[model samples]
Each structure stands twice: as C-alpha cells, then as structure tokens.
Target: MPGERIEGYATDPSALIERLFQQVAERSMVGLPFYRPQLPIKACAFQLLEGQLFGALLTPWMLQLMLLPGPGQRWDYRRADERLALAFPQGEILFRPGEIAPDLYYLSCSLLSPVDPALSAERAVALAENSVRLALSLPVRQTSVINTGRRALLRGALSANKG
Candidate 1:
C-alpha cells in the first residue's frame, strides 16, 4: 500500500525535530555542517512518509523541513518568501502555515521527486532513516521562559483541581 504513515512518538515538537535530524545526518547522504542559530524553535511536527519526511517547526515563526533520498543539500531562510525561485535540484523545499495557527507553518520535501509509490521497501527505509538524521542535526532552539511558565502553571492548576 502507498502513503502508509509510520508510527513514531516524540515527547514534543522539539524532541521530534531532534530525532528526525539525527536520523538524516547519520546517513551522510547529504553533507550537513553544524550550525547554531540565535532563534529557538518553539515547536515542531514531523512524520515519516514512504519516500519523504514532512514536518514544520514553529520558531515563534514558522519554518519547514523536508528530506528525500537523493543528494543531500541544506537550505535555510528567515522569511519564507525570500527564496521564490529556489529549487532543490537534490531536494525541493516548501512551507505552509499550520491550519489553526497562523504563526505556525509546515515544511515538506520529497526525497524522490515524482515520488514512486512502487519504491522498494528497503529504499523507503533508507529515505526514512536519512530524514530522521536531518531532523536531529537541525539547530536546537530554546523555548521561551514565558511559555514554560505558562505550561507549568496550567499543569499545576490541573493537578490541584483534580485532587
């Protein structure tokens, strides 16, 4: 069957991104150099697809990440629209806002363009592995203290009410 959603769990968006990047980087399919950015990712959503891994990260602003099975290349941007004609000869990049949250958006990529549904299981696994490595290598963003505080307060209140 095609379009099978692989089962995976992440503690949070950040954790998920880290796991995915790690998987991609280890494959060494693409040369990924370490980079540290000032802005931290607020959240992320990632998934393993047959020939690609699709996910979005919220850095208080939205950014997308995609991985495919071809020559690995890296692309980064602060404003989504900055690179209108940018194309990933090895892999392409695209972004969209989260359905409910405008500040949040999604990033998607296809390892093999014109994705072949009939792609071999082994190939699919390889692609998925690379995607995960890419996710892990991605820069880790520090969560805002205000947001952390809010979460803690909410958790405490919920527990108190339950008791």
Candidate 2:
C-alpha cells in the first residue's frame, strides 16, 4: 500500500477507457487489444524499489496494481550473500528477494493450475501492463499491494515462538 492513492472524478467508464487507450498508445510499445469484460488484462507497471523494479502484477483480480510496460528481460535482485529472496505474487508483482532477509522467493497461492513461473514471468508483464491500462480507464476508488514478505516474517516469528 505504499504508492496507492484515490481520487474523485465524474467521467463515464467509456470516456475513461478511451483516455486510457490513448495513454497506453503514448506510454508503451505494446499494441494492446481492445478492452473486453471477459479478457485478461495486460501490462506490467513497475516502480523503483531500492533502485530496482520492486513491484509487479501477481494475479488477475488485483486490479488496483498500476499499469506499465515491462523491460523485456529478467532482473535478478539477490545480494552476494544470498541467492533467493522472499517473494510472492499479489495482483501482478513478485516482491523482491531482499525484501525479507531469509527466503529468496516466498511461495503464495499453490499452483491452481500448472503455472510455468518462467513463462509467467514473461507473459505477466504484458498482461499486467494491459490490466493497469484498463484499470486506469475506470473510476478507481482504492489500491493496495500484497506484501508477502511482511506476512511471512510475522508468521515465522509466531511459529518460532510456538516451538
């Protein structure tokens, strides 16, 4: 919930949609498809976290995540002493490994269906980018990121105490 913000507006959904389309055309290289109610969203809007892209679209329902284009390559975020870092997907991002000191990537939702993390890594950026573009087209009221690192740290401490 770091960069989340809400504002009031009077424009209709369609009008916002048109503006978002125009914005996407101006902001990204991906040629997004026309928006449909049943289609999955695209685009991966990222922000700098400790001098890197720290945020992402982890899932489909998290419509609150910002829309942006992917850099079209993988970014490794581990320190010299660590290989994997705590990470999980919420909305559309994989929380960076350094976010938590212990785990390289924290697991969240089990594979509902077989998910190729590698493939997803590539496709999601596109989907997230599109999704953000679409969401920006609507009358948004709220937004939040899923911080799996924070949650896992609390859980680990509680479990350690119970032991």
**Best candidate per TM-score, number?**
1
**lDDT by residue for model 1 over 12-58, one digit each (tens)?**
24464544444433454233232222224322334444433444332
Tell me the lDDT of model 2 at 123: 59
lDDT over C-alpha atoms for residue 113 of model 1: 34
Worst 10 residues of 1 by lDDT: 96-105
Model 2's TM-score against the true structure: 0.20
- CA-lDDT, candidates in order: 0.38, 0.34
> What TM-score goes with each of the models?
0.24, 0.20
Q: Which ranges in model 2 have alpha carbons more than 4 Å from their true place? A: 1-43, 47-122, 139-163
Q: What lDDT, from 0 to 1, does candidate 1 have?
A: 0.38
> Which 10-residue span in candidate 2 carries the lowest summed lDDT?
103-112
